[model samples]
Target: MLAVPYPYLIARMRGLKRGNHNYYKTLRNYTHIVAGSPFAEKVMRQAYELTGTRIYKNTALPFAWDLLQEERQQQIRREFTNYFPQSEGKKIAALLVFGDISKMKKTPFRNVNMQELADSIGKDWFFVTNSQELAEASYVLPAEYRERFGFVNRIMPTQNLLYIADSLVTNNCRFAGSYAIRRKPVHVLRYTGNVFEKYVQEDYNDMYIGQIDKEMVKIQSGQMRPDQQAFCKEMSYDNPKEPYGVIGEILTKPF
Candidate 1:
């Protein structure tokens, strides 16, 4: 079996200072480590120097992120007909909340209460996350709007959900890359939260640095950053094929 670790555990394996002891030691037992992204490969190489096929080997190709076909989009619409009807009055927002992190000092919300955000944005907003975010949000959400903005426990072809959304906000959220590639307007918040906030935090990063107020106004009108085109192009892969076929060829054929 192959070990395909994402950035989650890779960033945690560390030693005293110079090198990563955990990855180096553990890598000795595996035939190969399949890195999903260039960032993941960089993280792995930082943890341990790549020796050969036995230690580490990467195809260097990102996972297939082809554009969502029209049929698939239609199917998703049909599957979740209630959530999205005609897509006119949507004002949809996809908040990728991994962990609450509201308690953290530098968080976007900072000292603000979670429930406060409920009143800030209009209706038709929803969250896309597993159990962790769902549990974190249960307490802070205002009771009246709970059913208005529902939660998706899980969705097959997860990218479909992002396609339906007009805006995406995330904080160190793992799947933000997917959203960027889909050409959907993505906002990587300084911290993660289930409740989507329209308040633009300019000091958070250089992306929203100078024209933050203006950008906030634009975002309110459902316009994405003009600079995100390159990002979407670079990160997206239109190929429908999986890399597993290459893995099989490599194992069977001599080189």
Candidate 2:
């Protein structure tokens, strides 16, 4: 069996001094490992070197492809509206919340009140979030916002929802890369959360820089014009093709 760890984990490992000793050691046993970026590949190679284990074959590729078909946009929009009737005639903005780091009692996190953020952006737009985000938000988000926003509790593909969404709002979210295929306006709220904040406190050599506050006036007005090409390139998603086919070809044919 092949090992394909999440790229975020690999990035976190790269941020660490020794790349989490035992984890990479165990990864040596896999026949092949897939890396999502050059940085991720570098992390794995360094880890294998430290363990004195032979580094297996691996390739760095974009995590997701352009699954947003042009023809399917309307179909997806209609399907989305069935679930989120309030979203009709309003631009959809996806608020991606991975974990409630702000309300945690374990450590002091820069207070991130998502409620206020959502309220500021939802003037003419409607919001959507998954069940996990909604659950985490219950502690901070009030009932009005919760009731107003659409909750995708089912096993629907996120790409489909994003296909219909006009903008994205994320805070320390893992699947932010997936949304990069669309190259729409994205507001990155939080990055320094979880163990990353700890790394910052210890004054370690951290590469993860926190980007906060996109202009709310532009974002809410649907006038935000970010460099789409640059953002896609940063995520290594400029080409946007199915990754599995590329991986298969890489395994079968020599470079």
CA RMSD of each candidate after superposition: 7.5, 6.7
lDDT of 2 by residue, 44-87 (tens): 66555333333333232343443356667888888888877777
> Model 1 scores what on Cα lDDT?
0.45
Lowest lDDT 10-residue stretch of candidate 1: 195-204
**CA error at residue 90 for candidate 1, angstroms:** 3.9
lDDT of 1 at 146: 60
Which candidate achieves the best lDDT against the true structure? 2
How does each model score on lDDT?
0.45, 0.52
- Give the alpha carbon lDDT tens digit for every residue of 1-255 in model 1: 233333343243323133545455445444466553443445455665455644223332333233345565566656655553433345666554456565676644334333444444444444333334443655566666464354555544444566566676554324555555456666655344222121223212322322221233334445555544443443343332345665676578555
Q: Name the regions of candidate 2 deviating beyond 4 angstroms.
A: 1-26, 29-34, 38-63, 71-74, 100-119, 131-148, 154-160, 190-192, 195-218, 221-232, 250-255
TM-score of 1: 0.53
